[model samples]
Target: MSNTTNFKNLAPKGLRIIEQTDSLYHYARVISNTRFGYQPVSVAYCKDASHVQYCVKFCSQNNKAFRIRSGGHQHEGMCSGNGVIIIDLSEMNKIEYIDNQPNQAWIPVGKQLDSVYTELEKEKQIIPGGGCQSVNVGGLTQGGGWGYSIRKFGMTCDSILAAEIVLANGTIEIVSEENQPELFWALKGGGGGNFGVVTRFKFQLSALTDYVTTFGLTWKHPEDVKEVIRVWMNLHASTEVELDPALSSSCTMILANPDEKDLDCDGIRELEEGQKSFVDGRMGGQFYGTKTDLIKLLKKCFGEDLIPEDSKFTLLKEVCYASKKKSLAKSEKETHASLARHQSILANFLNPTSTPEQEIRATNECKHRNYRVLPVAPTSTCDQPHPHKVSSSFPKKYTCDDNSEMTERIYDFLSKCCYYGDVSKYMSFHCLGGAVKKNVDKRVFAFSDKPYLLQIQGWWDDISNAFDNQSRNDEYVKWVKDFRLNIAPFTEGSFINFVDQSLVDHPETHEGLLELLEIYYGENNLSRLRKIKAEQDPNELFKFKMSIPPLIE
Candidate 1:
């Protein structure tokens, strides 16, 4: 722990290595809040790719496992506690336009989402990305970045024109379809930290439209829950392709805040206030719930009979049944109105009840859920084309749509697996769509012939003694694995940002990996990548928990 320690003697000349007793927690919580594993041997902060190369060489020479760090927001906190050397990429923040007319920019992998947005605004360019302000572009794009722009633009990966990567053996290489198409496809929607350390990315930038609109709508009362969902689904089915709405929903339990709740004896006003209070408290507490794909649930709730089967694969589901009681409290006036009309439309669907109170009681007893839906923004892509690229599994042309679809798909899968139980909602991004299915050779993401839509989501709350904590975690992991297992048969790939931590357990979950190989190396892509891995750094100097296989020696 000393400044003059031998450990310091091995450090890179210009790199910054912070090794101290106080650094554990700082490194431990980088971006992931999940449970931890064995802590790192130490943390090393690299100023640039040169430093990263130095760390990789050092680790290789000394024989050590190393974890890459960019934004600490890694879902499972995999960057820490692996008993490896932590090469923190959070310090490498640089954004510069490599070409302006073509709208291309070179961004360091360490930049955060907020910083990127702020900077892009200044540059009069925007790369549609995951809206969560805290997410790092490195982790998000590598993990299949999705956000408000996906539906309108496509995914962040779609915008990736090229990248500078330092492979496991400490060899620096520029990865693009023309240079190393296989590696390029894998990195797009393939999940990061697995392939190698991404020093800088050359992204295709797009002009930001002057007209941007945002909207918010809320529904109250338990009786209206099902109706609201039904209406929302119906609306989305015929929704104008130009209008994208991010959707979300939840059920609540009444809270005891007197200020929020009034004495109910006076009437509906008190009841309405009480309902608001309950919602606020619910947000304050752990939400026991689920977030599902609007497209999928639209089919589930309204029946798949309406949507074409070919399009069903585009639908996603995330379900959650809460152990806590769902509230049905409503103002007397609202209840009275619903009861009056109950017999006319939905009345036949339920047990015929005479009074408003009876109707509320019946509706409460029935299943009720809430939802939210939003459209993804469009992606930024390189201008012109890189034609020399000759891989079957790779896409010849890069665009924002590629990244949008992948991220939205992952959002659907993750919402189903991680947050299913207390409440449910849906969201979508206004992204580029018409070009999703374009068959661009046999390259990666060749699932369809049209542009794709993207969505984003967030929801969850803890429940004490709800389900055994250990059991819940185990169940969550299993659920994610099961989905990954089933995903390949239906679609070409999934969203990278929503990449599950259990990718190691089910390699098939990453259909993009093999597909990229097929496109880049043709029939022998994996073999070629392995051979390149060997030629570049003969010794496997860098590593991640899961990665492309080394050449079969």
Candidate 2:
């Protein structure tokens, strides 16, 4: 049958095709809407994975480029391209609790993270996942999701017990540890939309215990801000707290300060006193809210001298003071895990040196100029091995006890952003060589093993300003890649979920993708992955630029 005829017959009976006026607009919508700048050729909203198979088959027969979409949350939009047929799985939103008693749930590919969380909460259970509620389980789980529960439990990939996927040839297969185990290994943390189109995920749900505590703290004075960060890094490194605060360690240039109006006499005096030691005079600072022991820690870090006038200290103190009062009744045996769970706490130790005043300002300037400030940190902060090859923190060096060289290497990376000269303030989080690394199976979520999960962002309200010139954009991306490359010796892996698409053209940095495969499937099992990719996708029709790269010779 003709390709056109096949597509017509394959589409769902009630499915509408707008080829005339709305056709281009429909495709354009998915393309321009992606977080990454990747352009899309066309888009088809599938009613189910069966519809996805039909779209794939149709694109295959026509020799057209294609991409898959499941709640486009990937920082790098692998689901979009110039002339690709986008199989949007947004319509396949069905979530079912398979076993409520055992805390097992089956979720379709299209359902957003928030929807899943809401639905699952009704059953008094929750799946371990990321913060972005709109993200799809298919992509997030495949990439080894990490969120609020990351420090407490592990990742979304670790909790996954099984999955149902549609192969390239339109055959549906259930993959798990028992069935097609090798594929299962590759699927977890291998990056999604590569092996096959996932339809549903079987998540191992856990009992939702304790109320999630959240708060935001802000600092205006450079010196006080530095002090706040310095103290946070040091405290987090040494102290083991039951409550984990997902700290935002990125630099910011505040055009408008929300706390500026609220500041009064006492708050200003405290902040000024805190800045007395530093050459720069302290101005103001405030906490948006308070949670757990975070307030006390902040106070201890900055000291009372640096507090601002008319600040919200009374409320903060009241909460912390009350919480501590309540905790006195409990036993010391109800202990929480500490910073020791991580292999290294260099981020905290080197916090003072890396994030000093001048670099912070420069990073803030980068934000002002809308240039991407890349975040760099110690490999010890990561959960697994970093993608970097030269100096690694994972597979702890028991033999070489003196880690001064490794420490220096980390300081240098931190210095790139924290120090006085050429400091970049791109954001990154700890994801390597910690409890998550030692406890979880790296083969299942190898990407998380990397020392750092970075978010290289350039904030600009103007759409025309981002890529005004491709060369400038290229330079910014290359600089971030260079930062990653420089750390390759220390870090042995990279987080795929945090990958920035602008750097996809650079193959060397992406070497982590290959390393990820090795960690999961092992050298022996790689042949099987290649064979499956070849057999299921002979034309390599379903492949994305950053998905599964052909195994090199």
Candidate 3:
């Protein structure tokens, strides 16, 4: 725990190394620093590719495993381990335009997507990537970056022109289709934290558009969830491509929050003895055209003759970069209503005079993101990160003609929702198609071409409550677990980015995780990726919960 530790002493000059006892070490090491815990030997921040090369060599010489860290929105906290050395890449973020090729740019793996977007905005170019602003370029593109423009442009990896990777042997290679064709193929849309430390990415940028027509529609009647999902599958998903590749949609069925009047003190902390939550659904997306054409197309899908009375739609004012902020003015109204509810909920436990300040603090702390625009402000950095769990699946095509069965399943899924307070639980479905299908033959990324990706999420205050210390965490995870099982019969595969390892006894070698691997990278592509791993990292030095393993034991 000394200032001049061996980890620091061994580091190449100019590299930043922090000991385990340092406050910065905690923030530098983990993003999803959950209550379960991940302890690393030391955290080293690499300024450039040379630093990464030295760190890998240093780890090998010291008989230690090393994990990569980028935006650290890394699901499962896989960046940390008992005796691992963390190659922290947050400091390496830099976006530089390739002057020779005006349409091309070099982006560091460590830069968050929002920061990348903010930087690229000046250039008036775009990269079809993530909307969840905090995710980094390395982790997201590694797992097939999908976003509003994906249908128009293809996955994030598809836009890459080249990359600079530092391998296990500390050799830095400039990889691309022409140079290291095999390595280039593997890096494009391959899962994150695998292969090697990708220090820099050379991307082919697309011209930015002025305004993207985005829309949000919700079903008024909660009981209509079943019929609406059926109509979506029957009308929208089946033939979206007939309209235009630029148009896409994502529909989700979620548990509705309790009425604010009912969310009294007992409901916020300890739930009322027996209050029930309702189920609702939302469907929304964007198009590469004007609002008029978007609405005309929506009418075609919903039935031009007669739009459903229960449905409501709105066109957002935000452009392509902020396209995901499709929340209408109504959502803003809902936010004010929610704040009022929170104020009342806080009044129960806090002094009346201090409630306003506490409520404001709670609102800011929540990181309210639904109405956020471009340069989506990220939560303030902190050493003490909160804990949460999420899992996802891909149902390639919905064949369930029985609306009642789907409705019953939806009810059953929401039935296990938080029985207590303001803690939230819901399901999110994102639409997939367009260039995804056209680009499938490219064989570059891990994520498959699927019609829909479903996110099963649960969030709570902390690790637990007073009665059962781990109950809250257990409950949140179990909800996703049970929901996964219930929907297993319907879903064909799982999204790699979701990173659920509850079934894999040994992610390093287990067949169960491998089964999910086939779903992610496909058997043939996976074989190719494994072969590359075998040759590049024969000893499997860069192994973690979900990192690609070498060909053999």
Best by TM-score: 3
Q: In model 2, which runs have C-alpha deviations exceeding 4 angstroms?
A: 1-9, 14-28, 31-41, 99-102, 221-425, 430-435, 447-452, 462-492, 501-539, 550-553
Model 3: lDDT of residue 336: 26
Q: Per-residue lDDT tens digits of candidate 1, residues 117-137?
A: 656644345686664555677
Tens digits of per-residue lDDT for model 2 on 384-408? 1111111111222211221234333
Best by lDDT: 3
Off by over 4 Å in 1: 1-7, 20-29, 99-102, 220-494, 501-542, 550-553
Q: What is the lDDT of residue 509 in candidate 1?
A: 47
Q: What is candidate 3's TM-score against the reference?
A: 0.79
Sort the predicted structures by TM-score, highest score first: 3, 2, 1
Better of 1 and 2 by TM-score: 2
lDDT of 2: 0.48
State the TM-score for model 1. 0.56
lDDT of 3 at 329: 50
The whole-model lDDT of each prediction reads 0.45, 0.48, 0.62
